[model samples]
Target chain A: ELKVEQNPLFLSMQEGKNYTIYCNYSTTSDRLYWYRQDPGKSLESLFVLLSNGAVKQEGRLMASLDTKARLSTLHITAAVHDLSATYFCAVNTGGSNYKLTFGKGTLLTVNP
Target chain B: DAGITQSPRHKVTETGTPVTLRCHQTENHRYMYWYRQDPGHGLRLIHYSYGVKDTDKGEVSDGYSVSRSKTEDFLLTLESATSSQTSVYFCAISESSGAPHEQYFGPGTRLTVT
Candidate 1:
């Protein structure tokens, strides 16, 4: 079984602050993906980190992956209330067209 | 938007009843998937289709069955609804088959069994 662990399962921060959520997997993976979900809402794609030292940014959200460490981080810059949501990271192992294994998720709440 | 849609955004059913969830896509993508989301467990794949009439089981396929008759539509059926089957089901699609592709998801369906 592939295990994915995420840090700080729940986080609360004020607007204008910065924080990073971490995702670590048990074994090698083909790729990493980040997703955001608001309460009762569907998942919204945030980032797709494909390689070692891979980094991608969209607005205030930035994601980075370090395959050597089997770790990925989602950094939030200048957080806003609208950024409050549950964030999930998924990994697709390269073994024989494997399914996605997801983290437990980190629930972030940005206070205004 | 991937133009993926899941029918019956919210549903309530009784135990022992049968229910079917629909996932329709307009992107003409070759890959489609069904997943169930729950607290602490994240998203667990129920089934997936690579092409028309080609469906495969996922990790949580025990209580679920799936059929894909058309390229754009995938159906997931619960043979006998149970309380443990209550979850939020999501439909997703991907445009590529090589390696891992980013999956685009629909709004999701919330099923409650009482």
Candidate 2:
């Protein structure tokens, strides 16, 4: 069974601060994904890290993947109020590689 | 928004009652998935369909069943609703069962079994 774990399940950070959410997986996987969900809303795709050392950034958020270490990270640079939401990291593993096992998600609260 | 919609956005039912949730997509994607989100558990796949009449069980598919009779519609049925089944169900669609094709999600349906 492939398992994904994320750190700082609940985070409250002041605006303009920097923070990183970590995602660690148990098995080998070539693909990783980051998603964000607002309260009572659906998930919004943030980034897809396809290879080791692959990094993608959007606005103040950056995501990187290290497949060899079975780890991924979502870094928030200068967090803002708009960045307050729950972020999730998912991994694709096993034979089919179509199903994704997701982390418990890091609920970030950016306070001004 | 990926043109995906889940019916009965919120539903409450008693235990042992049969409940069915509908997921409809206009994107005509080749892959459709059903996932349930609970506090501290994130999202767990319940079932998925690759094509019409082709479906497969997911990690938490014990008391759930799925049917896909058309390209744009997928149905998830709970044989017997249980209190443990209460959670927010999300419907997702993807262009294909391959990497880089991110899954587009629906608004989700909240089901509460009493």
Which candidate leads in TM-score? Answer: 2
Model 1 spans with C-alpha error above 4 angstroms: A94-98, B97-100
lDDT of 1 by residue, A38-107 (tens): 9999998888887899999999999999999999999999999999999999998534444677899999
lDDT against the true structure, each candidate: 0.91, 0.92
Indicate the residue-level lDDT of B50 in model 2: 78
Q: For model 1 chain A, give the 10-residue run with minimal summed lDDT.
A: A93-102
| Candidate 2 residue runs with Cα over 4 Å from true position | A94-97, B97-99
Question: Which candidate has the highest lDDT of all?
Answer: 2
lDDT of 1 at A93: 59
Whole-model alpha-carbon lDDT for candidate 1: 0.91
In candidate 2 chain B, where is summed lDDT lowest over 10 consecutive residues? B94-103
Model 2 Cα lDDT, one tens digit per residue, B1-114? 789999999999999999999999999898899999999899999999878998988899999999999999999999999999999999998885556878889999999999
